[model samples]
Target: MRTTHAHPIAAALAGLALLATLSGCAGSTAARSDAAAGGPAAPVPAAAGAAAADEKAASTSEGTAYAAPGASERQLARTAKLTLVIPDPAKAAKELRGVAEGLGGYLLNENVVTEQKDGYYVEPSTVTVAVPGTKLDDALDALSKIGEVRNRNVGSVDVTTDMVDLEARIASLRASIARVQGLMDKAGTITEIAQVEKELTSRQSELESMLSKQKALAGRVAMAPVTVTLRPPSVVIQDPNPLWQGLTAGWAGLLQSLRMLLTIAGALLPFVVLGVLIWLPIRVWRRRRRPNAPGLLASVLAPATVDAEDVPAAKPLDAPRDRPTTVDG
Candidate 1:
């Protein structure tokens, strides 16, 4: 026998072929076993292909979810309250509306009151507008230009963590949806199918709800809201009817006078009491300190006494009585 040596390339090819055969056999056996066990009997390759498709869809949704975060690194929502005093309210209101519209913002709320004070109506004092976050500063400047800004408050809320968490949740939900869909596909019995479908439906609803929340959050982050308040100048009301006005004014003045009097009395009452308490003790102490000083209370309440040195001497009536008595004896 001529020594027959196998070529290395041929040996490698044979090994690969044998391995493929064994893999196919094992795959077939596994499929049959799964079918007997009332599970998915699809070939492993087909299942892998489906799984690949699901992952691709999941990845697509993940990309969509992250798009907002990439655009909103700052993720700061801003709001402001403004108090302005304008000369002409109607003109000022119109100007404010125009400014909001020019900034590509819309008035979320606009209210006008027809009630007039003096001769003119007070334009709406409250105006709520929503503008792009980038345009907020410009909008505020334009609004300030319209009139003198009495009060201006600017506030910001950082939502970076919230937005980031929302994206992560969305990605997780997409993955869960993919898993449920895979379960739905593998379900063979009607009961299994119904159960899987129910779960899938519930998950899908939650996912959609989360999507809506994400959309709203993203919108708020992108657009900033600035409120421009147009305050009309102060006006005094001049009623045409003066008779009733005079009567009411007189009554009001009387009541005001009484109130002021009562307020003064109330304020002075405590001090008066305190002074009386203090003066009583001081008077007592002063009288006790002075030797000759009689108490005012003693002079008013006690009877006066006379001393023996001040008594008058008996008159000669006593001597005459003594002489008459001796003669009679």
Candidate 2:
């Protein structure tokens, strides 16, 4: 200890200063790290978790909201008026009604009229029925047995888009309303509460409207209307007295034709007489204006050129060729 050399005070002061500077730099680095951890711009782990949860909830809600209406919409169905023609209308009507009943349907309207042939036989009758849309094919099959199906028409309209969209909107609005109600309950401030309440009211109104539209769509999809027309079966009637009937018809037709012809002739008689009266004067005038026949010589007279050529033509031709100035040939 007696032999150790003492350090200079200035040197000791410089060493202490350097140590203090290094310490200050380390402290500043630690403060900067702590500040970065608690800074306003830094990502908050709790906030990130909450944001992820909110996003998941929104995605789920939207998925539920936009879902389409189910199978009924996918399975579009419709029926159109079908017409059948048969020879005998009355029998066809009965058969059509039976077919309708057989096909799980009912006759909505029935009309049959037996037009008589010479007030003797039933001509035909017609029947109309209302059948279920699903049973239309069955009804048609059964009707085919009764008579021929002359016409068939099927039609459908698309309302699925509207129905599906409305249903989705309804679900979404309901979910949103519920969410808003939850917010309203948790909201402490009056301003937030009021805003949530307003949003809830609007959503509720939209929900009601969507529900109304859904009901209307449901009604349309539930029942389908089918129209069926029945024609009578063809019936051939043979009369033993066909000859008599034919003769009677022929006589009647002949009489009718003669009567018509006479009537037409009588109708045209006045016009024919008037036409004759108009033509008489014109004929007389034409006849009067005709010239009397002339003498045979005058009637057969030749043209001036031919006559001039034929009369001493040799001498005239020679003179014209020689003396053009004397006369015009």
Candidate 3:
């Protein structure tokens, strides 16, 4: 009976040990998997490491945020406007185009205007071109040799911050897209797969937009825009003598007065012709009626003649005979 009791106790003890061993192995395996998946197995260390990484990234980004004072790494978009008075605007414009091409640039736009000046056709040109940002000063210098610069303006804009922001966002979107793709691969249901795919598509679209903006911004920083306005040299007449100046002024005034009078006459010519055309017909009509008018006037003004027996004979002495009979009575 003691042997039987010992056997049962030993079996129970062995089973318990085996169960404990199994539990330990499972716990270790789970802990390793959680660590590999960056799960909550070691939350405190992971959090600390993440914080350190974030601080490091922030410090590095801040350090490289801007270029040094004179460094060329700074992204700048440069533009210049120049007004030049040259002898021949057309020729100058052609030369300017060649200059831009020589400097590895291209013309963006050109407008040539032909105007009449002093009985001569003058062609003035306005040209816009782009050149390498580094060669902007050189281009300006070369252009200055083409003509006398009457006006000049140079401007610059910094886009480093925008470029940096775009780059960061693009990187983030790429990582997010990759993570979503992984999730899609692991998805068990159609709904989860569709949702992951939709998220991926959205992120990809955002990434593409950011890339486009970045490319445009980079192009602007790489090239500088220049606008050149070329005009013909003005003619200046110099007369030092006061008498000659006075005579010239008087002649100019007389010519201006004559021009004004001619302009007034030209404006009135049509109205005057219209008035004469209307008056001539009326005058002709009145002349035709005047021949009949005289007869009507004669009929109205002539004295009327009375018939011979129409007048009664005047009484001669009847009044005197009546007065004498009254006196005798």
Give each model a TM-score: 0.55, 0.36, 0.54
Worst 10 residues of 3 by lDDT: 35-44
The candidate 2 region of ten consecutive residues with least summed lDDT is 1-10
- Per-residue lDDT tens digits for candidate 3, residues 1-329, read 44433433333223322322332233344233323433322122444335434643553464343321123357888999999987666788899999999999999999877676784446667999999999999999998889998998999999877776665554444433443444444455555555556666766677678667777887887789999998887767775899988999999999999999999999999999999999999999998978788888999999998987998887776554454435555
**Model 2 whole-model lDDT (C-alpha atoms):** 0.55
Clashes of each: 0, 5, 0
Clash count for candidate 2 is 5
lDDT, candidate 2, 181-219, per-residue tens: 444444555555565576667656766776676666654
lDDT of 1 by residue, 242-273 (tens): 89889989999999999999999999999999
- In terms of lDDT, the poorest run of 10 residues in model 1 is 1-10
Query: Model 3: which residue pairs collide?
Result: none
